[model samples]
Target: MKVGAIVTRIIRQMVRDKRSLALLLFAPLLILTLTWLVLDQESSDLKIATIDVPDSIITTLNDQQINVIDIDKPKSALKNSEIDAIIETAGNSLRITIDDSEPTNSQAIMMKIQQALVSKANVQQVEINHLYGLELSTTFDYVGPVLIGYFAFFFVFLVGGISFLREKSQGTMERLFATPIKSWEIVAGYIIGFGLFAIIQSFIVVLFAVYALGVPLEGSFWNVVLITLLLALAALTLGTLLSTFAKNEFQMMQFIPVVVVPQAFFSGLFNLENAPLWVEWIGNFMPMYYGAEALKEIMIKGNSIDAVVLEIAALIGFSLVFFVLNLGTLAGYRK
Candidate 1:
């Protein structure tokens, strides 16, 4: 009888929280659906334009299992980043200018072209020029640093935001204020605690991405570490600052889609060729835009530190702005 009564009470309590029930049952499904949509899919067909190719070569290309589009001008197609590679036949030799924005596509196109010419006894050497990615390695290599920074930023943001929110919700913040704590002191303490964690987290995440995931780290590892720490600090400060406006943990969670999602759209994940002029400007306002760009340069281009000074400066500026805003927001909690 006692066990039955306890079970009934537990069921009643769970039933009362409709939101909790819905989140428990539906959130995992939604996440898995999105993951499948993005990462677990097969490679899309690579579209390429052949310009002035010989009749024999064209016939061989047509025989291959690939999408071939006959384009009027090679310049237009390449400029638009449409075609993966342009095959132009001048006499017996083929001149290939590959849209090397993505390394995998570049490699695939090169391999296919070679296979198409395999039967020819006099295989002319094709000159290959990469449009975006130079003599670099993998396509995933470019996104490595950016992904590391993003994961660090995201995790710290959620953890810090919720921690600060809990302090307010549990009335611990009020108790602290009643004692000798100043608003800035409380903010500083939170920053230090979270900031230390951010440093360690950034190091581990970057190292894992570079060494374990085989994401290229052409630049100095310390520079990557410094940039990741700065980015995480920016996220931490932004999270704590935003938490001031949030009434509860649910409200804090709402900020993710609003503030974080748009950044990804501009962060080099998708080719932004079709984006509007205004949309391009929106990227200039985002911190991730600079971070992703610099990260790409460092990892893929093996660019020197001087090459990314502007981006590093912009990231520091973002951190400063968020820190100042955080300090201002904490004034609200002051007695």
Candidate 2:
């Protein structure tokens, strides 16, 4: 019950972990900067593509400094996310085909296109069509996919990270290393085993959100599950790998701000694209950014696997990188 002895031990432990001390002090600020840069930046002008309209329409949009692209296959482009909206004519009727995956953006695009058409000539009427999402869909529907992925990653990361940290702190890692199991085998087994639970968690969370909470599930539920499971794999592998850096559960929690929070900020939950050139490039490295995009495409856009193949590949790539890194890091615990 010596007070001095307890205080000295605490100070010694904190001093012993130089990396954890640095992470605790600076990681929050770094995450805050990224989040603020993304969430605080103003949105850019909408991207517009003209289909079979007149030269005057494209000229008007280009004149407005809007991102205007003249494309031959407007429908394919919109589906492929090549363009935000298309300006066309249907039997002399002016029609605007919008990629309505984001309702707010769709509204803005519609307003801009209307202004463009009005400025051109006498606008009698205009037809509006949605390539994906409903004009009536709420913000909840738009961000629901991100929420689902965030929650899935959040819980899985905590469980996976803490579980591995416990094994390390409790000396089970060294005991397992004492056996003949290769590092990759241990890593693979952890992924395959914990991945089963992660998949089930994804299913429950998605089902509850869509069916119980009435969040819009415009696309196939299976697609949502696929993207979500991939996201979980990335989180699981990342958590286990990062555990190599943490000495205990508190240090593992330290990763939450740096690893999890930044991803949520850029995961399309908030559209902060003003500093797009660099900030958007930063988001490319986050695993959840890809998952959120894929989920939005499937849950709201009703897009299939082909439409979001790039995002899927990104998530898979993240998982693979973290998986390999986990193996490499695990070698430190054993050989």
Candidate 3:
């Protein structure tokens, strides 16, 4: 009887919380819908170039599911990323030069090209070459940068957001307002204060993942740290800003599926270019998209600061926008 009564009371409380009940019923469906909408599309075209190739080889490539584009210069095309890869024939030798920016795409390109060459029943002349990273680099290396950003953002957003959310619950915000603290001071204080801890956390996570955990680290440690820190900042600001709209801690967590998880799906965790058009456009709005792209360029493509400057700029822009929005939102507390 006691156990039955406890269960009955729990059920009554759950029914009273309509948002929680709706979320329990609808969050999963919403996630499934967004997932199907984004992932239930055909892949985008993969462009390959054939240079000085025999007619038989060209015919074979054309028959495959890839796009064969004419390139005036194969070397320049591979270097410029104009083509995914190039299959070239010189005398009796056939060689492939792959643009290995995204390691997963590189693997797909190689497998398909190899199968095409083998189907001809003559592949003695076939050879493989990579434009960047090691030929032996694994999928882990390719996704290492993204995982780093996601993990850092994941932990910090929860801790920082929840810590602030507690202020509202414990009447800390009201207490603070009774003092002389300006609204902007409250906002800036939280940001700058958490920022110090976030930087340390970013350094530790990046170093641990790269050195201790054996993730691929082709870029300078400093560059990886820089990108991860910016990602953390974006997470911190975004989480804090969104926390204002959440009435309680549970609502704060609801942001995970709505805000964070969607970004993970669209942030190069899968092939961004392969998703539906509207879904791919969503990637442009995600802060994680730029961070993941920057990490890939730095770690796999071996790009420098200049090459990834645009992504860094986007991250900073996200941080600034969120910070300003927080200020505006907090103005409600003042007025």
TM-score of each: 0.66, 0.63, 0.65
What TM value does model 3 have?
Answer: 0.65
Candidate 3 local lDDT, 184-206, one digit each (tens)? 77767677756766777677777
Off by over 4 Å in 2: 1-129, 133-135
Better of 2 and 3 by TM-score: 3
Question: TM-score of predicted model 1?
Answer: 0.66
* lDDT of the structure predicted as candidate 1: 0.70
Worst 10 residues of 3 by lDDT: 24-33
lDDT by residue (16-117, candidate 1, tens digit) is 756643433333234333433443322347676787776777677667655678777767788788777787777767788888887667777777777677
Better-scoring candidate (TM-score), 1 or 3? 1
Model 2 error, position 248 (Å): 0.3
Q: Each model's C-alpha lDDT?
A: 0.70, 0.75, 0.74
Better of 1 and 2 by lDDT: 2
| lDDT digits (tens) for residues 216-322 of candidate 2 | 78789988989989998999899999999999999999999988999988899888767667888889999998999999888878788899999999999999999
Best by TM-score: 1
